[model samples]
Every structure is written in C-alpha cells, then in structure tokens.
Target chain A: MTVAIIHTGCANIFSVETALDRLGVPHILAEQPAEASGADRLILPGVGAARPAMEKLQSAGWDAALVAETRPLLGICLGMQLLFETSEEGGVECLGLLPGHVMAMAAFDGGRLPHMGWNRLHFEIADDPMLAGIDEGDHVYFVHGYAVPVTNHTVASSAHDMRFSAMVRRGSVMGCQFHPERSGKTGARILNNFLEFGA
Target chain B: MLAKRIIPCLDVRDGRVVKGVRFRNHEDVGDIVALAARYAGEGADELVFYDISASPDSRTVEPEWVKRVARAIDIPFCVAGGIRSTDDARTRLFAGADKISVNSPALADPDLINRLADEFGRQCIVVGIDSREIGGEWRVHSNTGDPGKTRTETRATLEWIEEAIERGAGEIVLNCMDQDGVREGYDIKQLTAARAVCRVPLIASGGAGAMAHFEEVFRQADVDGALAASVFHKQVIGIGELKAWLAQQSIEVRP
Candidate 1:
C-alpha cells in the first residue's frame, strides 16, 4: 500500500518517514496537494504553534485538500491539534475535521506543563481498528503543551492535569496527540493498524 | 499517571561511545546505533546522545548517526552538544532527532534559548546544566566541567533553572559534576533544590551506581526521569532488570 505524508514545513517529518520505512510500507513525501490526493493513505504531521502551521497549510493548498479528503488520514502532535476547530496556543482557527477546541494543558497543583513523558492510554472505544492489538493502559510518549479534551470522537484518552483526547477518530479522519513514531512498540502496532485499516 | 522515564545517555566522542569519570579519564564504550537499539529493546523510556567533543569550530554531531539511530530504534531520542543555533538544531531534528539539547552555548548566549524555543517550539528545546557544589552551594558549571576547558558560572543552580524555564526551556537535564560517573547514587540534595524552581520536566544525571539509586532519585526528588551512561554501558545494570525492579518497588515504569 502507498502512503503519502503531507510535508507542512512546520516540523520535522524524518521520524515519521523512518517509522513508515520500518513497517516496510512504501511512502512518498507529498509536498503538493495533488501528490497526496493520489495516495491510498495520507498523514499530516506537524510540531509548532497553530497560527503559523495553518498559514503554511493554507498557502500550500493542504488546508482545502485536507478539508475535502475522504480517505483514511492521520494527524500527529500539532498536526492533530490542527484537525480541531480552534486552538488556544495562537488563538487560530484550524481544519475543523473534528468537533473540539484545543486548549492549553492545565498545570494545576504544580503539575508540569508540556506533559512530556510516557503516559498510559485508556481506550474509550471498544475494538477500534486504529487501536487493534494494543491493550489498554499501554504507555505512549507525549510531548505537547496543548491537547484536545475527551469527546465523543475520542478513541483513547490520557491524562496530565486533566483528561485529554490521546486518540480521536471520526470516520476516515483521525489524529493522535502523541507521536506514534516515537512511542516504540505499541506505537509501531498502532501505525501498522492504520496502514492496514481497510485491508 | 505518567511513568517515570529511564534514559540511557550515550556520551559520544569522535563517533565512539565513551564514559568519563567525573568529566575526566574517558573510557570507550561501543557503537552508538547498536547501543541505542539495545537500550530501546530493553525498554528504555528514551535515549540521549551527547557529542562530547562537538564545538562551534568543529562540525556538530553528524546527521548520518542521527539517521542511523532513528532507523535502528523505535523509541524517542534527543541529541546534544554543539547545537549553537537553530540551524544546527534543525539539521539534527530533520535528520530524525526528536529533541535537541543545548548546554555551554546556551550559557554563553542566553537568548539562544529564546530563539530556539521560538523557532522549534519549547517542547523540543532542552537546557542541560552541568552543576557542581562548591562552598556548600550548587553552582552551574560550563564546558562540561572539564577543568582544562573552562570555569564555572556565577549563577546559582536554582537561579539558572528559574531563568531557563522563564526563557522557555521545556526540560532540564541537571548533571551534578560531583556525583557524575561516581556511581554512588544520584545527587538528591542538589536535584531536590533544582526541582523546586523547575516547572518543566526535570531529569537527574550523574551518580547512578545501583538500581536503588534510581528509585531514590525518583521518590525523593520527584524528578521526571533519571539518566545514566556507564552503569548501563558496562552492564553493571541491565535496563530490563532495573525497570522490573522499579516496578516491583511500586514505581511506575513502561513494561
């Protein structure tokens, strides 16, 4: 199967590219929207503030392409936040593929910001194809200052100072707040599931 | 709950893994890629590679090794040393490094931290402080504590930690020069003081001799992670065995 990774130019995509390579999956870095349109799967990976990221997507024509995309698409880290309606990081409007607002993580009671480390994932959906073979309470590496809250679209939820959506799925579009490429074995399993989503 | 991280630091000099005793008397370890893969397989939470010899005049840690390690291991890894500018950090990050750590350079130009944090986001910017206790006060040391290289800064350990966080540092890796490579245990007394002012994830480096030492640092200082080099490189403590032992001690670790 072929995978197209949308290069937003806002963050590094090397780890994600290497992850796909390890899976023995053939993928291409789609710098333009047309290249991504022809792929079997698409992935939007980013890491930075929201306003500038949206501006890059808009200028590169990915914003419109992603909005019209119907195939299985995945967003990682800041890319996941971009799938939401709005973000508090830069107070910028996003792709709005999912129904939620991205807010800064609350550091209540001296909780650390950025929530950097390995945290356990609690699955909210039963037998999700995206989470196949991954057991509940499995730890995944997370590095972010803002996250989406738990909602009906959340497939798995993890907490820092408050519960947030670790994995969100709505039809063919999905997003992960954590970097699956950097989360090790469990992360590899999740990526494999996404690659084999519809056989 | 966020599981406490167990990081295996690889001190690389001229592309070979080396461990030094108190910032002196270096001993070669092994290949960077092989060791990185081994640690990741053994369930290490993360990996750190510091190019000990990287300087502004010399080439930064080659992107070739970073790419190899990223291809070899599935876990996250950070690269340190000689990252003097955003361009240097960008090269490593684009070459597959998940994070870029800065030390001496950040001290020379404190604004470098702000620039890095602004361009690459604070999550990927880590400020490493090499500290030494002198006259009963924890002092921040520059040039990796090598007496031949440079001298210590006047800024107190806590003062630097506070400034780093204020300037947008996402994490702090406090390396206690007095305890580094000693293997007696982590410098809890110093780490505890740094932890009070550090709002970001704090990692304790230096003086990890036994498995109990890991537990002590985690429990007493409540730091987010513990980093050691020789102990794991010399096979004094296996990552798997240590994680299992930590789990048995009621400390949360990724299985």
Candidate 2:
C-alpha cells in the first residue's frame, strides 16, 4: 500500500519516516497538495503551535485536502490537536474532524505542564484495532500542553493534569496525542496496527 | 499519570560514550548506539546525548552518529550542545533527534530559544543550566566547569530560567556544579529554587550515587526527571533494578 505522511512544515516528519523505515514500511513524505493526493493512506504528523501550523496548512490548502481525503489517516501530537474543532493554544480553529475543543490542561496536582514524558494508556475500548497487541497500562511517550476532553470519539485516555484523550477515532480517521514514532517497541507496534488497519 | 523519568546521560566525543568527573578526566565507556539500545531495553525513560566536542571545537552536531543511534533505538532521545541556530536545531531534528538542547549558545543569544520553540515547538527545546552556589546565591553557570567563566550575578539563575520559559523553553536541565559527580545527592537547594519559578518540566542532573540518592532528589525536589551517568555506566546501578527500587519506594517510573 502506498503511504503518504502529509508534511505541514512541522517537525517529527523525519522521526515518523525513520520509524516507518525501521518497521520496513515503505512511505513517502508529501508536502504539496498534488503530492499528498496520491497515497492510499495518510498521516498528519505535527510538533508546533496550532496557529502557525494552521496558517501554513490553510495557505497551502492542506487543511481542506486532509479533511477531503477519505483514506485511513492518523495524526500525531499537535497534528492530533489540529483535528479538533478549536484549540485554546493560540486560540485557533482547527480542521473540525473530531467533535471537541482542545484546551489547556487544568492545574496538575504537582506534575509539570506540557505533560511531557511516558504515561500508561487507558483504553475506552479494550480491543481497539489501533491498539492491538498494546497491553493495558502500557507506557507511551506524550508531549503537549493542550488536549481534547474524553468524549465518545476518544478511544483511549491518559491522565496527567486531568483525564484527556490519548487516542481518538471516528470512522476511518484516528489520531494519537502521543508520539508512537518515538515510543519504542510499543510505538512500532502501534504504527504497525495503523498500517494494517482496514478502513 | 505521567511517570517520573529515569534518563541516562551519555557524554559523547568522537562517536564514543564517555563519563567525566566534574566535567573533566573523561573516560570512554562504550559505543553510544549500543549503550542507548541497552538503556532503552532496560526501561530507561529517555536518553540525553551531549556532544562534548561541539562547543570546544566550535563545530555543529554530528548528524551521522545521531542517525545511527536514532535507527538503533526506538525510544525518545535528545541531542544537546553547540546548537546555536534554528538551522542547527533543524539539522538534528531532521536527523531524528526528539529534542535539541542549547546551553552556552543560549546564554549568548536568549532569543534562539524563542526561534527554536517557534520552528520546532517548545517541546523540542531544553534549556540546560549548570549552576552552583556562590556567595550564598544560586548562580547559573555554564556547562564548562572553569571557575573564571562562572557568573554569580544576583538574579542570573532564576532570571535565565524565567526568561527561557517565557521565550518558550519546554524543559529545564538543572545541573549543579557543586554536587555533580560528587555522589552526595542532587542539589536540593538549587533544584527547589529553580522548581519554584519553573513552569515547565524540570530535570535534576548530577550527584546520583545510589538508589537512595535518586529517592532523595525525587522526594525532596518537585522534578519531573532525574539524569545520571557514572552510576549507570559503572554498573553501580542498573536501570531496571533502580526503576524497580523507585517503584517500591512509591516513586512512579515506567516498567
């Protein structure tokens, strides 16, 4: 299957490409609207503020292109936040793929902001296909300040300052607030699950 | 809940991992790729690779070595030292570094932190502050241990940390010169002072000798992570066993 990782000028593209390469998954990074349209599956990888990232994507027409793509798609980190309706980060509107708003994590008991580091995944659906082979309480790497609330669209949740969506899915489109590309063996397994996922 | 991190810091020079006492008397450990893979397998939460040669020689980061390690280990790892510009950070990130740390260069140009945070995201920038107590004031020192180079300005340490955060530093690596490699324990005074003003994740580095030292720092300071070198390198403490001990002690760590 042809895979295209949509590059919106955010970092972590090479990390994702490297992860896919190590998993022996052939993939190409597509930055242009024309280039992004040729893949069978797509991934929106991100690592920056919502305002600037949205500005660049909207300017290049990727925001509309991505929403229009009916193929299986995955978003990571800021890319995941961009799938929501709006974000308190930079007070920006997002792609509206999912039905929630991304807001700042409420004051943590004593934890740090950005909620950075490894945390266990609490699955809403224990047998989620995207999390196949990923055991309960398995640790995944996370790094972000804004997060969507746990709603029906959330397939998994993780608690840092408060309970937030760790993984969300609606039909064929899914997103992970954690970086599966950088989460080691469990990360590689999750990527494989996404690769093998039949939409 | 976010688990407390156990980071193994690898000081690399000429592609080999080295351990230094007080930033001097360096001794080679092993291949960085091999050690990084071992640490990841042993349940190390993250890895910090400092290019010791970068600042001294005034050269850029070694992307080839970074790519080698990135390919070998799947866990998140950060590359630090001698990064001065957004292009420098971009080179490392494109080469697969999860985060890029800036030390002396940031001291020279504080705006680089904002530029890096804007381009690569705040999560990708770590401001490393090597500090020590002088004249009863916690002063921010450079990573270099030269006494003449140390700055004891009244508000230098806390001010730099606050400015870094405002300018967009996602994390802080508070390495205390007075306690580094001494094995007495972490610099609680320094850590607590920095933690008081630090809004981002604070990583306590240096002076880790045994399991209890780790416990002391985690318990005493509200740090998000603890970084060590000699203890892990000399087999004084294994990552797996130490993590187990931390868990047993009620300190949360990834298994």
Candidate 3:
C-alpha cells in the first residue's frame, strides 16, 4: 500500500519522511493533495506555524484537493491542529474538517508551558486500528504547545495540564498530538498501523 | 500530557562506529546496525550521527551509511557534519536522515538559515552550534574545514542563536566543545540564553558525566532533550536508566 505525506513546506517533514523510510512503505512527498489521492492513506505532518501552513496549503491548491478525497488522512502535531475549525496559535482558520477548536494547552500546576515528553493514551474506542499493538497505557512521545480539546470529534484523550485530546480520528481522518516519527518503536508501530490501514 | 524522548548519539567515521573520550575510541565498539537496533528496542526517542571524518572529501558516506543504518533503527536518525546547504539537506533526508544539522553555513550567511527553513521546512533544519567559554563569555566556534583547517572564532553564542531561530532553525544543538570530553556538565548558562528566545526544542550536548548530569541539564536548563557521548559510549548510563532517572526526577519519561 502507498501513503502520501502531504507536504506544505513545513518543518519536521523529513522526520515524517524518515519514519516512512524505516517502515519501508512507499510514500510520495505530495506537494498537493492530488498527489495524495494516489496513495491509500495520507499523512498531514505539522512542523511550522499554522498561519504559514494554511497559506502554503492554499497556495499549493491542497484545500480543494483535500476536500475532494474521502481516504484516510492522519495528522501529526500541527497537522492535527489544522484539522480543527480554528486554532489560537494563529488567527488563521483551519480546514474545519473536524468539529473542534485548537487552544493553548492548559497551564500545568507550576510547570512551564509547551508540554514536552511522553505520556499515555486513553482511547475513546476500545479497539482502534490506529492504536493497534499500542498498549492502553503505553506512553507516546509528544511535543506541542497548543492542544485540541476532547470535543465530540476527539477519539482519545490524555491528562496533562488538563485532560486534552491526544488522538483524534474521524471518518478516514486521524491526528496525534505527538510526533510518532520521533517516538521510536512504539511510534513506528503507530505509523505501521497507519500504513497497514491502507496508507 | 506530553511524551518523553530518548536519544542515542552515534559517532561515525568512514561508515564505522567509534567511541572515545575527547574524540577517541579504543576499538570498533560495535556495529552501527546492532547498536541502532539496541537503542530502538530500548525505546530511544531519536538517533543522531555526528560525522567526524578527518578530511571533508568523502562526505557522501554518512548519507549512504544512513540508508543502511536507517534500516536497522526504526527511530528518527539525524545526520550532522558537512551539511551546509539545502541540497545537502535534501540528499540526507532522501537518504533517510530525519533531520539535517547545519552549523558554519548558517553563521556565514545569515539568510541560509531562513532559506533552508523555507525550502526544506524549519523543523528539518537543526542548527548545531559548537561553543566555548572565553573570558567567561560563550562564543560560537566553527569546525576547521579539515584536520589542517584551524578552528575559527565566530560570533557570540546568544547573538548567533537569535539569528538561527529568527531564520527558522527548528531546533538548537548546543555542543560545548570545551566540555565535550570534560564530562562535568552542560553549560546551563548558555542553554538558558538560547532558551530565552528559542521557540523550538533545545538539545543540550557536551559534558555529561553521570545520570546526575542528565538530571542537572533537565532540571536546570528545562531543555527538551539532553545529548552526550562519553556517558552513553562508556556505558555510564543506559538509555532506559537515563529515562528512568529523569522519570524519578518527575520528568515525564517514556515507560
């Protein structure tokens, strides 16, 4: 199966690229969503600012192409953030595919912001293909400042500053707050799962 | 809740793994593939290869070696050394490096940082800074072009760091050359200065003696990750133990 890493010229694209490389899954570095349709699954990787990301997507004509597809789309950090209706990171509105809002991660008791490190996942669905082989309490690597709340669209949530959406999958579209590429073997399992699920 | 990170630093020369204190390793410690597998199995967050070849002539070896090493480790592997342009970064990324590290070129031409960020994206471009304290002030130092090329004094640490981030270096690697083999601890002051304006993750390198040093860097610097050579090489601390120690310190680590 082929998976396309939807590229909008954001940072961390190579990390995603490397993750796919390790998995040995053929993937296209799709500059636009049209190239994405060639693959069974699509990955939206987040690495840079939301404002510029949206601008690049618009400029690349990815918006229309993305909307036209019904295939599985997995979103990484900023990739997940952009799936929401809007994000506070940038005033720019997002894809509005998922019915949720992106807000800053709640303040930790006394810790600094930008919740960085590995944490466990509590799934909304008992058996999720995307979460295959990942034990219920297994820790997944995360590096994000803002978060997507546990709205109706949130499929999984984890406790941090406040309980927040850690994973979100909705009708062929998926997202993870963590960088699966950087998360090691467990993360690879997740990426592999995505690949197996027709990526 | 955020996830913890585990990293393994690999010193590669002529496609072989070597380890030593002060850039010296006794023998071929182990196969890069085997060690990479061990790190991946042990739940490493990422892997980094610092190419320390005597001459900069055979630069393509690292990326080629990365393709081979990439097969062994499932974790993200970053490549350092002789990476100065977007083309070089592209080659490495295509060859299987998760991130490409840039140093001299970033400082020599301020715009190269942003240009690279715009071209390859910011997070893929890691600006590796080798610094040393002179007169109680940290300064950026460039690796001599070759073994014969002399190390040149560059701009102040913080000043160049500001430009790096401004130009879109997604991450900063503070490689303290003086403390590289000293094994005392990282330069917390230098890390703090970079952290003040560093929007991306800060990886603290150089000067790690024991697990306490890891704790020191994590606690004092509040860095996203800590990287060291001698400690990991000499088996002072295993990846799991280091993560456990950080966990004991109440730092959320991957279990």
lDDT for B6 in candidate 1 is 98
**lDDT per residue, candidate 2, B35-119, as tens digits?**
9988989989999999877765677888898888888888899999789999999888888899999988888788999999888
Q: Relative to the unseen true structure, what is the C-alpha lDDT of residue A99 in candidate 1, on a scale of 0 to 100?
A: 93
- TM-score for candidate 1: 0.98
| Superposition error at B188 for model 2 (Å) | 2.1
The CAPRI class of candidate 3 is: acceptable
For each candidate, the DockQ is: 0.82, 0.76, 0.34
Q: What is the DockQ (computed on Cα atoms) for candidate 1?
A: 0.82
Better of 1 and 2 by lDDT: 1
Name the runs in model 2 displaced over 4 angstroms.
Answer: A36-38, A106-111, B143-155
lDDT of 1 by residue, B1-255 (tens): 899999999998888899889888888899999999999999999999998888533558798899999999989899998898999989998998989999889888999999999998999999999998889888988877244875778989899999998998999999988898989999999999888888899999999999999999999999999999999999999999999999999999998
TM-score of each: 0.98, 0.94, 0.79
Model 1 gets an lDDT of 0.90
Winner of 1 and 3 under TM-score: 1
lDDT of 3 by residue, A32-69 (tens): 66666668888898765788888888898877777776
In model 3, the runs with Cα more than 4 Å from the true position are A1-71, A77-82, A85-95, A101-129, A132-137, A142-149, A158-164, A192-199, B1-6, B23-30, B54-62, B144-148, B152-154, B188-199
Chain A (alone) TM-scores for all candidate structures: 0.96, 0.95, 0.92
